[model samples]
Each structure stands twice: as C-alpha cells, then as structure tokens.
Target: MTSRALLRFSSCESLNFPSTMQHAAVISCVFISSLLHTGQFALIETKETVWAAVGDQASLSCRLTEDKDVLQITWQKVLPNGEKNLATYTKKFGSRVSAGLEEKMDFQYESLQSCSMVIRKVMEEDEGCYRCLFNTYPNGALIGWTCLKLYVLPTELHGPFITISRSNSPPGSVVTCSATGRPVPMVTLTVLHQNLSFSHYNTSRVSNTNGTVTSTTTALLSALSSTQVECSVLVQTAAFRELLVTVPGLTDSSDGLDEDFESDDKDERWLVTVAMGLLVVFLCGAFGVLSMLWFKKKHQNR
Candidate 1:
C-alpha cells in the first residue's frame, strides 16, 4: 500500500472515533447541567409552616417555590432533649420513611413536594416546635422551623349540696341553710306562707385557700305552722358555674299538737256539763214526787 492511502485511512478512523463519542459527551454535559440547575432551584425554594390545635388534627407543610421535581421531604418534631422524625416523602421509594414514622409516631405522609404530616389526634405532648427538611440532588438541603402552642379549656362545674337546720324558740323560729360550690357561690333564700310571699334573703361567700365556698342565711317565721321555703344557690367561675334551687316544707313543734290538745279539753268540758244537767234533773224529779205525796196525805187528814 501507498503511504498517503494509509494516512488517509488513519484520519478516517480518527474522525469516526470522534463522531462516535460526541453524542455520549453531549448527553453527559446536559445531564450535569440539569443537576446543577435543580440544586440551585431547590436551595431557593424550600419553606414551610406547622399548625396544630389541642385535641385536634395537626399538619406540617413543606411548600416549594420552584417547580422542579422534588427528591425528598421530611418532617420532624423538635423535642426538649432531641428531635423525633415524624414522616418523610421521597420520589423513588415513594415514602420509605413513612413506615418508620407510622410505627413510631403513627404519622401519615401526604405527597412528595409536601412533607405534610397528618398527626392522628393531637395532644399536649404533640405541641412543640417542628422542622421541615428537603433534600434535593445538586442542591444539598433546606430546613424550615415553626413553633406551635396549644391550650385546652375546662368543661363543666360539679356541685353544691345544701342542708337546713332550725335552732331557737318563740312564736317565730330561726332557720338556716348552707351550701358549698367550686367557685364562690351566691345564695338566696325565700320564705312563703300559704302561697303568700313572706321574706327574701341574699348572700355571697368566697373560698380562701381551698377551692370551696359556703353560704348561710337566716329568717324568722311569722307563725309556728307548716311553711314552704325556697333556697337557691348560684356559683360563678371563669368557664362556667352551677345553680341549684330547693324548696322544702317545714313543720312547727306546736301547730298540730296544740290543736289536738285544745280539742280534747273542749270534749272533757262538754262531758262535765252533761253530768251536772243529769244530776239537776234527777233532784227536781225527786222533789216533785215528795211534794205530791205530802199534799195527798194532808188532803186525806182534813
């Protein structure tokens, strides 16, 4: 073979080699450029917030400003001593970290772009700071933190039991009723006679160191007979309080017994009057018989 022909063949082989490697080199360069762009976009895009209510569901959101495909998103709770991973979202494994979260914390993941964590039923322990972390390919990682506070309110008030006692003497009697409640209670007492209004009293008492209050009221009755009395107690607090009303019929010591004794005395007096009348009638009949006999004997002697 000629030297020029041999050189030409070598040049053709070199040109073919360059042509074969061009497509692969272009693909590599494009892929690297895409990776760099994705990294930069991810670095600028990660931001999130966490919101929760006591005794309700809570959510942590990881929102991306960039429209690029996300690699992985993670949610974590910041405890006093350490951090606890709640949920994770990934593109390849689709949510590989969710199993760990479900097993440990029972948290559920929503989506890839969203590291949104759905906490089952929120509680006092669930309240704290949380972090949303995003791990992107070329861009390293991004972290967003949010602090949450939870408050729970009270439900209802319990009770106040009232008791009444009578102590003292006279035509009028003194009666007292006492009650207790959580917060300070307002007490009102009303006395009635045969459906007629007699007297009304109102008073309030507060608890000192202990969380209890007692109220008392006194009233004088007009007569020593059966009377209907109504007592009402009202308690007020921050959330709510309770109101209790009671009506009680009271009996006097002298009413029924005195009436019965008087009736018995009247019955004895009537019996004595009947006996005197019978004695008078019997004496009159005897005197009449004696006079008739004496007059008849005198006529016969004459």
Candidate 2:
C-alpha cells in the first residue's frame, strides 16, 4: 500500500510539513509498530551485553528473522566521544574490512540470514559498547547494541620483600614484607619451614598514578624463632610470586653495637679532618716565626 494510505489507516500523525516528509515519518513509525506486532521487520537479534578477558577472543553474532533482504551490516565500537566503525560487510561488494584493526576481528557473513564477528585478543582499550547495524530497504535500519566488559588479568606479581632487622618498639626484631602488584594482589607472610602462619599484617595501599595499585604488607615479629620465612603474593589464583628468606633472631646489643660503630666511624672522620686543619695552622705559625727571627738578625748585623 502507499505510505499516505498506510498513515491514514494506522492513525499516525505528524507535523504540518510536506506530505512527502509526513508520509515518510509515519511510514517508518508504523512499520516499526507492525514489526513489533509480527516480529518480522525486526531483523537483528543479538545479545544485550558481552564480556571478555584481555588476551582472549570474544564472539559477537546476530541473526535475521523472516526478513531476508539485508543489504549491509556494519560493526561499530561506541566510545564516550563517538562511535568508531570497525568493519562492514555488504552483499554486493563483499567485505572491505580494515587490515590493521580488522586483523583483530574475524567477521563472517551468511548472505541475509546471519553474521558473526570475533574480537581476537581483546584488550583493555576494546572494553566498551558496540553497535551492529543492519541496512534494510524500505524500512531503513535495524540495530542492536551490546556492551563489552573486559577483565584485564593481572601479570608479573613480584616482591614481598621480606627483611629481618632489629627493633626497640617491643624489645625484639621486626620483619617487614612489602609487595606491589596489579589489580590488588593478595600478599601474605608465612614461615614455610616451621608451619608458622599469621594472616594479620599491616597493609599500606597506594593507588598508583598509572591506574594500578601498590600494597606493602608489614608484619612485625617479636621474639619469633629463626626460621625460613616466605612472602607469597598473587592475583587471586592466576599468578603467584613467592620468596624465601632465612630470618635470624636479633638481640638489643647487636643494634647498639651497629649504632656505636657508625658513630665511631663518623667521629674518626671528623677528628682526621680537624687534625689536618690544625697541622696546617701550626706550619704557618712556625714559618712566620722563622721569617721574623731572620729579619731581626739581618737588621742587627746591618
């Protein structure tokens, strides 16, 4: 039927514009309504949201219902600013997919029935929303939107630097283990050899400038035995980093002895510097005295 007749029979209204413009709007609206009623003109059916991991592949697909005349299919990545066209498939022109970006996507089209796109090695930059558009004649465009949420898996979990040193806070030694990892890795200090374990440790967390996290866990050991200590760090159960440290007990006298040696070394350096200065002054004075005596003797002889 003609668009003007369809508008009238469907009771669709528009502004007092040109008959052509009004008819077009009413036709598009009425066509959408009829599609909803019969579920035919709505050709694109896809997932509302999709999730993937970094360095992994994601499958995005859509199938056409009874509507079989799909002229074009375009895939776009939506950002905060605007949408970026990733790839396009046309029945007449085949596919003119991009090489650099298109290498990441494996897009396949089955004429007017179905199409699928795979995102290879999905990255953090690929985490966003996507839009799939199907071009259909007479009815315009049918679209489906899906959000892609990516989990950036953690890597390189390193360093729970375990150190055993003397402390006077509780009149014993202090053991501090600090580590840094991405996605807030779990860090713990344990005595591996003796099966001594403690879960409570002082944690200092810092949000890094590069959108990562740094966690330093300090565990104070007071009067603990000399054993093999281990610093364990990981991102969930995915990655792990462990270091073994042989901890030795400390006495208060050892700390005092270290301080005393440092102080004595400084004092010796200072005394040497002062002694050299005094020797220079003494030599200058002796030279002056000899010059005066020689001058006086010369005057007396003259």
Best by TM-score: 2
The per-residue C-alpha lDDT of model 2 at residue 75 equals 85
Q: What is the lDDT of residue 179 in candidate 2?
A: 70
RMSD vs true structure, all candidates: 24.8, 17.5
lDDT of 2 by residue, 228-285 (tens): 6778887654578888886654544465678899999999999999999999999999
The CA lDDT at 266 in model 1 is 100
Each model's TM-score? 0.35, 0.43
